[model samples]
Target: MSTASDYLSRLISFDSVSRNSNEPVSDCVAAWLQELNFEVERTTYVDPRGVRKCNLLARRDPIAAQEQTLASGTGGLAYFCHTDTVTADRWTGPGGNPFHAVFENGRIYGRGACDMKGSLAAMLDAAQSISLADQMRPLWIVCTADEEVGFEGAQYLVDHSAAFRDLASLDPVSIIGEPTRLSVIHAHKGIVGMRIRSQGKAAHSSTDMGINANVAMVPMLQTLLEIDEQCRTDETLRNDAFDPPTLTWNFGVSDEMKTVNIVPDHCTAWASMRTMPGVDGREIVERVRRRAEELGLSFDLYSGGDPMHTDRDAPFVKELCELAEPYIGANEPHAVCYATDGCVLGELNRRIVCGPGGIAQAHTSDEFIEIEQLENGVRFYQDAIRHWCC
Candidate 1:
């Protein structure tokens, strides 16, 4: 197999930030996979901001290995990854370059190196290592866009990509390479978002003509605070398996009119909350909606898909634990505090989150993946491919 670091360097060079179109990165990956005899399909969607995003679904089948492959391969293995990273606006990598990949002190430094591009490199290299003729089942790879902003690309793929639906019919064992430091992740939290806004007439400071939209936002903000407190106090929503053990809230606010001389004609407040597995995220959504209706403020609510969870004792989970733990010196699968494409691709019921690098380095100004993790991730994926596909 080609070295993962080499592949990573090339991938890191493509600045596929979530806010920008991922065409360059997506096109590159699609071409690379196609060159390796994988049948690749490209799908696209327009983001809410009107940016054109892409998703690549690539597959390899050994017609000579099994008659099932000649027809519809009902069981195989699938690897999931995203092509986008958070903004590189705060990039502080070597020489103030985020797209220029660098190897320093036993780590690879670049934007998306740890967050996900490194994982993508490993997956491709591992898949390349296995010969098509030696594999009895199909191998599928899914690369989606906009994972950092939201799972918008994944959601679009799930809904529109016929190739994605075709692969899903195979009941493939799923692996989400989301920087778990190679420790198998059995579950993680889900995200919920709400946006509230008010509009009023703008005017001069001395004028009574101004309707003062800020006045309406006050009641909505207060209600959100009360709900946040409610979530913090709700023991039923707690999950001790995860750190912090409860749902957490993040609030963002802005007003159109910046000067104090005039009443703000437009005010917007948005909130993000993470929902634990087995917790009802809709409860919060419902409460926020009722408050908006009461206050007559326009509001929007979106669930970023359900929390992902696979039974700890499931056969696939056990096999993954046995295969991946020694490299990390860990014994069992664990839970994380973040969501992945698994939340959106739930139809592939057998899923695990395991990959190189730690989540702590993800999306940071100075992002990097330990060399050890990157190399081991390559071996882990190779082992998994041989065991599950070959």
Candidate 2:
């Protein structure tokens, strides 16, 4: 039997970064499930970059697939995890390779250790430890690709895959294994990523003939800042459940001219907004566009994920909290500030975010998961399986 730690080490070695193909890691997971007598369906799709990404959906019993009817009572349980991790170029461990898992000081250090191949390993171990014959409902494990880059793999599964269609039809109680330090998460902010481009005529800096796109962006940026301030001060957008209790915006990236002597003809700025549950992300985008237009600049809203909030009093959530409380100590269903693939999956079924490690450790130079936490995560998943599937 492979322990969670053993499975984590193998998963970490895959280097399944978001910009790269997740086929290798997905293949490993599929094979492992197959070995457990699961009927695996590999859904392959070509990403926008023409890279082939694979999403794996596995069920323990093959006959379950033919059962067209959804489970009526105590429906199936599905564990969802993303196979891709963000890029890590500055690893601080001994091997200096982000893909190489290193155990040190009671922690497993790797790129995806915290957010969240750790949870993936725990789910695998817990599933394998349980006897399928005792399960009252089908157990499904889904591994999606490109979660780090706008959840493209999840989007593909929801839009195109037949396996996901069947699972959605069943209305399974779902768990999205994002690292929450084993606490239950019922609410989280959404993200809206936008790219605004300012175009102007290029000329020598010494001459006033150039429109200077960089200069043109100043008023537009100020407009965004004002809008952000309004969002921060608005009580309507506040959700007291979340920390800070208001929408947050950041202008993180900019593309502009390289040389000092040339007046920039084109300038692009990338910004993201984190919105509360009831806030309208599309309205926010339109507001930004309106502001840009008023400032005489061209703008485009590119990508975003919706805010997610499962009722804390939901039966499944309460059951999960009860099941996880023993291992995690007073498991409270709280809200997080960051986004998850749950933003998409929550639309399909009743879902919660619960797993090992902390968001603080995710995507850091020294990403790691505490050994004890990893073990407890396995226990949590096992308890969930017993509660929901048995």
| Model 1 RMSD in angstroms | 1.5
TM-score of each: 0.96, 0.94
Candidate 1: stretches off by over 4 Å: 69-73
Best by lDDT: 1
lDDT tens digits by residue: candidate 2, 171-281: 788899999888899988888888888888888989999877777788777877777787788787778888978777777436456788888888887778887787755
lDDT of 2: 0.84
Output the TM-score of candidate 2: 0.94
Worst 10 residues of 1 by lDDT: 65-74
Q: Residues 275-310, candidate 1: write the lDDT tens digits.
A: 887785678888888888898899887648678888
Global lDDT scores for all candidate models? 0.87, 0.84
